[model samples]
Target: MRRRLLLSYVSLVVFVLLALELPLGLSFANAERRRLTSDAQHDAFAIAVRTDLELTPGSIRGSTALRAMLSKFAARTHDEITILDSGGHVVAATAGGPALGADLSANPAVQVALRGDDATREIEASGDDILNVAVPLIAGRDVGGIVLVGVDLSGLSHRITSNWLRLLVLGGIVLAVVLLVSLLLAQSFTRPLHELQRAAKRLGDGDLGARVKVPEDPAELRELAESFNATAEHLATLLRSQQSFIADASHQLRTPLTALQFRLENLEDDAPEHRDDVGGARREVVRLSQLVDGLLKLARAEQAAPPRTDVDLRAVAEDRCAAWWPLAADHQVTLETDVPIVAVRS
Candidate 1:
């Protein structure tokens, strides 16, 4: 039960954390991507501003300076920069191992930039994600080359992973704390129930004094404990009263029966012919005395006096059979005794 309760608490916490953190993590990733993309677009436009001469057709002198500027910008921004001619051919690039002179017209962003539109796209390259931003170079309403900047998602992915890891660690700590608290609470709750169960068992086993300590908090459980103790005490008092009354009545009745037997004996001496009637009355008085003695024994037994010795049922049965043998013979009935020597509680 404790394990189940603990699991229930942990599961609820995990579910809530996941529900909150999953969307939050995704939003954080997307926001970071947009911010990075905006910065890249700004950088691309800045580069395009300085590359007007390079973008002009047949401008050879500015090409060397443009390459140097692109290199510096790429190094500062950690982004790959490429300059494409109006024909969609890569003319200059900041990245090493460049695809110089490569026909980029097939790419959607390059085609859009060629048509004088700024374009941005996310694409997969070499098993990694890359963000491509294309800024068109406009030369007084005439189309010029395009400036394309590509940013790898590795850094973004790393930052996102780092954030998720931090959240995971924090969530783990919270769950641990919650688990500890749940365990402590479960112990607090079940401890009282365990005590109550033990007290009930003892009470059922005739230990009327057994009781459980009531908890202070959770008023309902406290009331229940109090009620149980009260009921046990009441039952004990009632049973004790009943046993005492039976014992007292049996003891008091024995005195009158003895006196009546004495009077009968005196009457028997005074009247000899009525001897049979007196004998029968005397026998009845003796039976009544025996019955009263049995009642007193039962009352004492009900009082639960601690046993001092074990009784053998086989010996007791044999003695009872022997004692009743004469009466059985007079009634023409057989009295049998076939019991094993079993020790019985007194």
Candidate 2:
């Protein structure tokens, strides 16, 4: 039963940890993803300001300086870059694609750019996030083109997932520590309980001396130990009382019975035909009287409430000894008193 309880407690701890960890780690990942997305959008907005007039790929023609700068920008950011012309066609793309004549008018970002709306659109294209920012390029008072940028979620989400695994590892470490501590505490508590159980079983099987070893730790366990000791103490006391009662009852009846036996032995042997019958009657009478006295004493001890008196048991023994002194002298038997000075059982 104790083992089951321990398992239950540990299970509850695990369940709660899972309940807390799953959602918390997922939220952390999502928060990081949001930060990544916002940073990507901000970078796209910056590009839009710089490319407000031409689809010249943030540079003039295929300038080596422009290519190097673009390469550096790609190396430093997670956002994907693309340029579109006034015809709503892709003029250039960072993914090494011919963006020169690809129609972009039907694209939501192109529509936003043509309408002179600085707009943004997020779409999933082939499992990649296309965060299109349609900021119209203005040439003197007219729109020239649109600059579109995309940020892929797969890579950023992978990073978020990596950090999540790390969090789970830390949580596992914490859970291990908790379990170890619980184990030590449970052993400390259950050991005493197990001992008490064994002791109780022993007492039930008539070993009244059985007792639990008191625990030193945990106040409650110590209290249980004390309670067990008290129970054993009471049981021993009751058992001793029963033994003393039996011994007293037997010893009390022995005296008069021996006397009656002696009287029976002294009956005449030379009597007539009626001698055997008369002798039997007298012997039965003596035996019956002794039995009656023993029964009466037993009945008195078993009463719902016994009489209480200040009778000194040893003093009573001494008085009985005095009464039998003359008889002991006649039989050449010595009378002696070896009673203790202190009080004793009745």
Candidate 3:
């Protein structure tokens, strides 16, 4: 019972944690992803505005300035930047990026940017997760070039993983505390029941004084214990009253049975022709005395509440058969005994 109660408590706690934490973790992950994507798109558009002013038609003077700006921005933000001409060929890029003059038109973000629209996507490049944002560079009502920004997502993934781990650890702590509290609660509930069980066993074993202690808290259990105690007290009082009555009745009967036997014995000497009658009357008086003795013994045994002991059935049978042999011989009957050597609690 205690185990079942504890299991139920732990199960409920687990269900509540799952219901609350699962969606919370997912929401945090999605929000983080969106925030990072928005920052990347903003950076891509900022670079596009600057690049639009740098690369004018038939202007070679701005090439050095553009490369210097791209390198500085890439170094500070740790993002890869690539500039593509209107024909989809890379003109300038950050160090370790796509080579200059390399065609990247087949790239989805590049293709979308070439169509004069902004594009954002998440992709894997060189075994690393990247969030790519592309925007068109406006050059006097025509597309001058494309500005592409690739943001590394390893840090974001790490942040999300760290948060999830923290949540898991918190859940574990909560579950541990719940398990301990549940264990204590279960014990508190079952301890009273265990005491009641022991008391009932004692009462069943004839210890009529056995009783349970009522608890102060938990009104229902207290009431149950009180009821049990009341029942036991009433039963004990009834049995004691019965024993007293049986004792008094047996005492009252013994005097009459003894007097009857004495009168019958005296009649035998006074009348020889009535000897048979006197003998029969004397036997009946003896039987009555034995019955009274039996009743007294029963009352005393009830008060004593003696412990049971093992008795050998074969020994008992042999003793009884021997004691009854003379009576059987007088009746012209033979006494035979067949008993197995078995032990039983008396």
lDDT of each: 0.85, 0.69, 0.86
Q: Which ranking of candidates, highest TM-score first?
A: 3, 1, 2
Ranking by lDDT: 3, 1, 2
- Candidate 3 Cα deviation (angstroms), residue 103: 2.0
Candidate 3 deviant stretches above 4 angstroms: 58-62, 257-297, 302-346
Candidate 3: tens digits of C-alpha lDDT, residues 1-346? 9989988999999999999889989999999999988888888888877886786773212298889988988888889999888877888899989998889898889888878899997889889998889898877667778888989899999999998998899999999999999999999999999999999999988888899999987999999999999999999999889989999999999988888788888889999898865776676677678878977888888444566789999987886676666668889999888988899998
Per-residue lDDT for 330 in model 3?
88
Best by lDDT: 3
- Residue 242 local lDDT, model 1: 89
Count clashing residue pairs in model 2.
Answer: 3
Best by TM-score: 3
**Residue pairs of candidate 3 with colliding backbone atoms:** none
Q: Which residues of candidate 2, in runs, are more than 4 Å off?
A: 1-27, 52-69, 254-346
Per-residue error for 294 in candidate 2, Å, reads 15
